[model samples]
Target: MNFKHLSTSVIGLLVLSACQQPVVHIYHEGLSDTQRFQLKQQLEQQQINYEFTELATPDKYNTPHLLYFPGDVTEAYIQNVERIVKGLGFDRFDSQVFSHTGHYYTKGNLGLYFPSAYSERVLPELLFAHNCGDQDFQIHIKTNGQWTAMNSPIDLKGLDLKWEFYETFFKLRRYFDDGTFQQQVYQIKQHQVRTLQGYKPAVTYEVLGHRDYSFSLFNCDLQAIFAD
Candidate 1:
């Protein structure tokens, strides 16, 4: 598409459409209000900026969310990509291109993505279990036109765990410090990936702690999460 040749104004519109931020809804379901408030206080204390909203009202709190939104991009990896996007002469609008650092929810490693384009990348299935002993998270990659599981995640005592998916030319897997695993697989053609019926990703603080959670299925071809 010769993205480099895109004009500044066109790029601005792209950035806007690609990186819209949404209100961070804090739900107190199943947990006491006190606990919810406590967690809320902690999040506020951590100084992580998020739109504070009550779950009771979905419409008033809803907003278009794009991966380019300030909070949406992992603080650990947004800077470099931001610089690149800026260098592209885009003044930050709807459609912006980014590269994954192959690292998720952790510092140093940055996962790149295009804010405006519908991506073929699918995050890994996140499973959560409280059995505190030893466990491993496994990831499978389609390489050489075959599917195979790479190294399992190192077991550790913690409530939250994660897995991530990204598009890459190579066939390989990756592990992160925050218990999240990642891998690159063959890119699916635009026709092959199905549209999700209803999908939304959110972050919340409960008695357990802060969590970045999401749910979606591309017509049952992929089932994924980032917790436990």
Candidate 2:
């Protein structure tokens, strides 16, 4: 979905919803397997200068730490991030957003995208169609201490992922009349999940909303906190 055009409006809404919290922007794109390997090398090599350890396995730093994330996220990618986060004794919190090629379930204030003038509810239904088989999602937390994001009481150590988007098809399938039909049906494939291996974690930060969603770290520096 060409959210680029709606970016401004969407961000404005999200900002309004969480006026008291900071915003930590994370940007990333999918990479091929070969590219991912190359990126990993680059990140590991730069860790020294960045004063951060690569979130890698084999105890690269010989530190005893745990990396936590939602099981819904691919294990390979999660492990990749875990390695680096654990290496720094950093806690990982993930609220897996369901995004497909055409549609996505990001922050609700960001709204949803669809081809036709479908109802707002259609957004979640299509975005999570793939996960419907499992009917769940999770909030993963990996922390050395029992610290939790305020107002978010589902202890981070571990919890079963569960989120079932309401399922009710539209009155009429609008594909016949909509050019965006194809995009609407698009989804992020399993292979796309593997591509995340190449991404790097940024500094620790917090993104506050009505409920604090602790993605605090992602593709960019999370250390930069800006309270609204």
Candidate 3:
């Protein structure tokens, strides 16, 4: 088979089709009236463009608790990938594709993701945006009866996040940056997009604790929070 002769769109379509995961439900238990109202208002006003996704509990059954501006990631990365797909006229995460400067929360380093997994390359430039600390999304959470906006959240201070939020550590351990890695992982597996179960958090306070960084929310039964 001449993969070299295949079209980029065809390759992209193949990868998209091969993706099979159940959809999870986004819960409202974490959001208060104010947060919900503010979120909706922001979307209507176009004041911000972001992706929001929360996971459910039990480590067996996962759900997406919420989502907003779903794929509205910084357009830089999207444009870069789209450009290459156009030039090569092929669209496989495989082969020799170069990802240009893109953005997650903002424009930073670009990366290349090869289908072979082994050939996936992460140049120094791609790690630039993640070499620093976290400045969480402009979202709010209610803890102790107060609605606080998480513009630049503090680690180990999980605040109002439920158990499922903690599980993200292990579920998508592929990358761990300030908080970008976990957040991106959650967004990709959004409940509104697919139906899947719990993958669990494997990060702890030792050994690979460097990744755990400032998050200390896994100390309790995240699922039990909903149970009680």
Per-residue CA lDDT of model 3 for 1-228, tens digit only, reads 767667876987887744421121222223333333544454435433333334222221122211112343345534543343222212222212222332122222122221111111100111101212343222233335332334334332433332222422323232234543432122111111111332211111111233343342211111101110
TM-score of 3: 0.16
Better of 1 and 3 by TM-score: 1
For residue 198, model 1's alpha carbon misses the true position, in angstroms, by: 34
lDDT, each prediction: 0.31, 0.26, 0.27
| Candidate 3 Cα deviation (angstroms), residue 50 | 11
lDDT by residue for model 1 (112-198), tens: 222222222332333222222334233343333233323423323332223333432212334467766543233322211112522
Query: lDDT of candidate 3?
Result: 0.27
Compared with the true structure, the alpha-carbon lDDT of candidate 2 equals 0.26
Highest lDDT among the candidates is held by which one? 1
Question: Whose TM-score is greatest here?
Answer: 1
The estimated TM-scores of all candidates read 0.19, 0.16, 0.16
Q: Worst 10-residue stretch by lDDT in candidate 1?
A: 211-220
Worst ten in a row by lDDT for model 2: 219-228
